[model samples]
Target: MTARKKGPPTGGSGANAGAPDTLEGLFPRFPGTKDIRYHPVFQGGLSRWVWRYYTHRLTRAGRWFLGLTCLLGLVGSTSLEIQTYIPFLYAFAFWTVAGAAAAFSRPRVAFVARHADRVCAGETLPVEIEIEQRGRLGGADLNVLPSGLPIPVDAIPEGGVPVPPLRRGEKARVRLGLLCRRRGVYVLRGYRVETDFPLGLLNAYRVFGEERSLLVYPPFHRLARMEMPTGRRFHAGGVALASLLGDSFEFLGNREYREGDNVRDIDWRATARLDTPILREYREEFFLRVAVVLDTHVPRGGRRDEREARRAALERAISVCAGITDYIARQEYIVDLFAAGPNLYHLTAGRSLAYLDQILDILACVEENPDEPFAVIEPQIDERLAQINSVVCVFLDWDETRRAFVENLRRGGAGVKVVLVRDAPPTLDPSGDERAGAIPVIGRADFERGVEEL
Candidate 1:
């Protein structure tokens, strides 16, 4: 949520800028009528009513009927002056006012409450709205404008029937159905509460705005790389350490000797008394962590081609990171994410499945900036390399500077996996020997195939 800046108070913004003399002076004053009620007003009694009937949507047939009615009405009032028709007009006016008053007496009403601001994808949350009558009145017809989400309804009208009448001050709690099908931010717009009130002759409506936002994280995806080092000890060359018994690591409970069991694993002291030999073991040591770096900026090339290439690259990077995080987490190893975008994002090492959602949320909103260079942030990335066991760099370009940075990371005893977003020519040394001491440079195709293999 963004912070809101406070502005000058309401009273300070107008000509009557001085503080209110009394508490009542501070509040808004409505003119004349003591009752704060709104009623639909119409003009010209029968004439207006007849005009409205004539204008019941100007179709060809409707216009002909309207002309015929006007002609007949004019002929029937031939002896009566427009003034002589006062009594009839008065009666019509009285009936119209009475009808409007009756409708307002039981104005249909609705109130929104218990709204949920957060929900996960594919999850349904119940929204509550209270609808009631305004005064000592009863209303039948009610309708909601700009309908809500398409979720199954839990409760219909109170009775096992539709269109139930509501009494004055009596309320019905409505549970609006809500469903989320995708992840990201969702904004809830205002609801249009409406009702026909006492009669179906006229409809009344009101707009209700209760601003809300929801942040949804992406769903989890499985990691398939089994050979990837997990929570296991590795030498400088990234090889898992062999577990040998009778070593100084620690002494675990002895177990029965099996075929091909190493003699060094045998517990000789236990073997002397018991007929069978037992082996001692220690808990495995683990020293593995992964640092994921996503490069956000894509350089200009062909318009669509560059965009498609950049998009493909970003996807590959996200896929690789997801796989690595899942694989490492499953194996009890820690993983962290570092984004080299206009917005710098860093998540510390964690071993839970929950972090996957967090990482994906950040990835979903990540975009490239033309001015930012992935190389410019190398120093900060280097600073974080001390604790991370491996650095996975996902970038579009691979120049000498980037190559040196990767080489430096490797020299600093950190494993480096460079997933190039674009294809790179075979790496050549300063001496022009393309094959000697060339670091493994996986192109976009290579990375895609690698992920599939994993």
Candidate 2:
């Protein structure tokens, strides 16, 4: 016989020999049946029913009773015993009675709320609400709960802000302290007025719709001193020319009048003394204009933990930028903020022209951009590079893109200061290009503990 043909190994030395063939592998295009229990139609209905039962119909005691009823029903169904069915039926009847009582016990009320337009993060926001009973029946055991705030339940009182029993047409005012966790613009959607009466097996609540907005500014350390590159460029009309149009000039010595010279500049005394037309020469005002370029670009596509770390780094960078702006605001320099997030942001504040609060407002709304932001930011800065004396760049990473951006700024004759915000010590040398100068790396831990000076 011819030499036996070699065959593939059945159980060894083959990639798929020992692997079990799965149905998914055999039919890659298989459209498997979805679990009906988890379908949106079922899930949404179930969740809504559960929420309504818990919030509107069920109380703490009712939940325990319901659980016991469910256990009894399961046992009765399995054993088909009359004795087991009796307890389940009794529990079910009690639940039905409790729910009916709660449904009719809902408090009919109207309310109004007032709060500040803005609050700093990590601070307690006080919301003042005035509730009035509208129904013929008096409202009792009322709880005022603010809705649409990202506040923890533990932060608020267990039963919410309790209001004493109110007679018909009576009103009560209560203050609710909302704990702000992070910085962002938030809207207070409404307030829920809830009460549990009678059997205390359910809570009857009515939601009052009230739309209000609140801005939360990021919390930042107050820097005692911040070292920035020393530079001042000539401002044609100083703060007036930079912001508005007005007179901002310094008087120099007297000189002969020119044809285009303003008649107002003619020095009558000098002209009289010299017996010739002489004019007072003035120079344009000069001041420091620093650009605080905040890097809000967060790379996309990473593990959950990695994405979180990147976000944390971005927040730290924001805090650093806030601190720098705070320090610059105290000085006499004109500060311009350049941040590239979802959109490009540019704000000018300083010399009493604008308040620091405006800068904080911009920072509050800044979001993370996944794409490289330097491309958009470079063009923005280039347009005003001639006016900007120094640039304070707050970057999350010191990668090639950022390095190139900074290098370009230095080439454009801007005094640049780089601040790298990272959780760990930086691995890449930020000073690889001497033209960018030495960069200061600020660790997240140090920032959290507080950096008094930068």
In model 1, residue pairs whose N, Cα or C atoms come closer than 3 Å (at least 3 residues apart or on different chains), thus clashing, are: none
Top candidate (TM-score): 2
Per-model TM values vs. the true structure: 0.49, 0.77
- Which lDDT value does model 1 have at 279? 76
> lDDT, candidate 2, residue 347?
85
Put down candidate 2 lDDT per residue, 1-454, tens digits, no spaces.
0112143221121011122233322222111111122222324777645544554456667778778999999888987645798899988887788778778889988888888877777788787889888889899888887643322111244346888899999999998877765777655566778887767777788877666666677789989987777667677654546444244578888899889999998999989998999998888677788999999877789786877788888877887888899899787578889887766778888876678888887787777888988887788789989888899999888777888888888887888898888875454677675766778788877887997886
- Model 1 vs. true fold: TM: 0.49
Per-residue lDDT tens digits of candidate 1, residues 300-413?
666776566665565555555555665665655556676654455566544442355566555544445555455555766678566667776665655565677667877766
Count of clashes in candidate 1 = 0
In terms of lDDT, the best-performing candidate is: 2
Q: Give the Å error, residue 211, model 1.
A: 3.0
lDDT of each: 0.49, 0.72
